[model samples]
Target chain A: MKVTVRYFAQLRDAAGTGSEQVEGDFRTPADLWTHLCARHVFPLGAADLRVSVNARYVPFEAPLGEGDEVAFIPPVSGG
Target chain B: MFVLQASPLPGGADLLPPGDLACGGVVVFEGRVRDHNEGRAVTALEYEAYEALAQAEGERILAEAAQRFGPVRVAAAHRQGLLQLGEAAVVVVAASAHRQEAFAACRWVIDAIKERLPVWKREHYVDGTRAWVACGCHHHGPEAP
Candidate 1:
């Protein structure tokens, strides 16, 4: 299933774009991350990042749906 | 109230809502961009956020603070984009009937924001190098083999 992926901070710098559409039969966020890592040299690993689907935080193992909006969140540093 | 904006944040006093007759104590916390970090002389900092989720999560944090320390009113705002040294990057204000709750709520809100907000800071050093500020609680650098 295809999904829209969003990147922020370091991931954004690595991805070279804020968001993009990826076409693949990705089963979960982890699967999608693996696919993305192959394309972009992200600074952090999947275990160090959090996954959000449709703007809500979810486990990396959570299932992905077609047209889902996914974001790989890096370590937050807001004050 | 929780807000993420590209414009400069309101002054600490301006961030507080109108006075509440029942509330006798008020506390405000402003996080400013410092000139140095990690032994490096920082020139400036840029903050980026997942606006949609950051707004939602930030509002949730304020709501949680209100519930946890009831009889208090809390509000917070975080600035986006570039910020110069000594500029207020974020602000939090809390008012309550007594000093303890107001102080506690204000502190709680800021701490929670640091941990949960979908915001990132990039520090630009005097030597022209830059790096994302990694939260000490997370393993953010190069991945382990």
Candidate 2:
């Protein structure tokens, strides 16, 4: 299955794009991240990054569905 | 209609002229641009937002505020882009039949706005430095001087 991944803030700058597609048999959010780390030389460290699927924040082990728009929400401090 | 604006504007103080209705109680909350953060002298602040989501989020909060506070007129707005010190970052106004509901609604709207909204703020320091607040990231890039 193909899953879409998104990065935000400094993560996006590091990854060089806001979104991308990855091909994997991953059934969970953690699986997807493992695939990305194994395949690409991610500019931003993927470990310790927050994960979200379909715009809602989620845990790393969150189940993955095909075509889900997962996003890595970089920590932001705003007031 | 609940209003949410991204452009810079005066705080809720400017909302008083919109209506002088017989509302027994009017409550407003204005968030100002402060001058200090994390022991640094903040010279100015800039805000960036996903506009559509921000508006939708604001309206959602307003609707809930009205529902929770009794029948009332509520308006909430947030300033976007570069903002100088003392400028208004956000304004929330609530007018109701009683002061209690009005105050409660105003407070709810502002707190909801801060907690859930997808807005990011960048703080600019007097020494030509800037940092993203709440950005829980290790500083691996060039440090601001």
What is candidate 2's lDDT per residue for B1-145, written digit by digit as tens?
Answer: 4454556765554664447465778887777888897789999987766455566667778888878877877887777788889887777788878898888877777667666555677889989988767643233221111
Question: Best candidate, TM-score-wise?
Answer: 1
Write one digit per residue (lDDT tens) for candidate 1, span A1-79: 8999999999999999999999886899999999998899988998789988998889989999999999999998876
For model 1, chain A alone compared with the true chain A gives a TM-score of 0.96
Worst lDDT window (10 residues) for model 1 chain B?
A: B136-145
DockQ of each: 0.57, 0.24
Over A1-79, each residue of candidate 2 has an lDDT whose tens digit, in order, gives 8988876556555677767998878988878877777755554555646666765557888888879887665443333
Which pairs of residues have clashing backbones in candidate 2?
A75-B135, A76-B134, A76-B135, A77-B133, A77-B134, A77-B135, B6-B80
Q: Which has the greatest DockQ?
A: 1
Give me the displacement of residue B30 in model 1, in angstroms.
0.4
Task: Give the runs in model 1 whose Cα sits over 4 Å from its true position.
Answer: B137-145
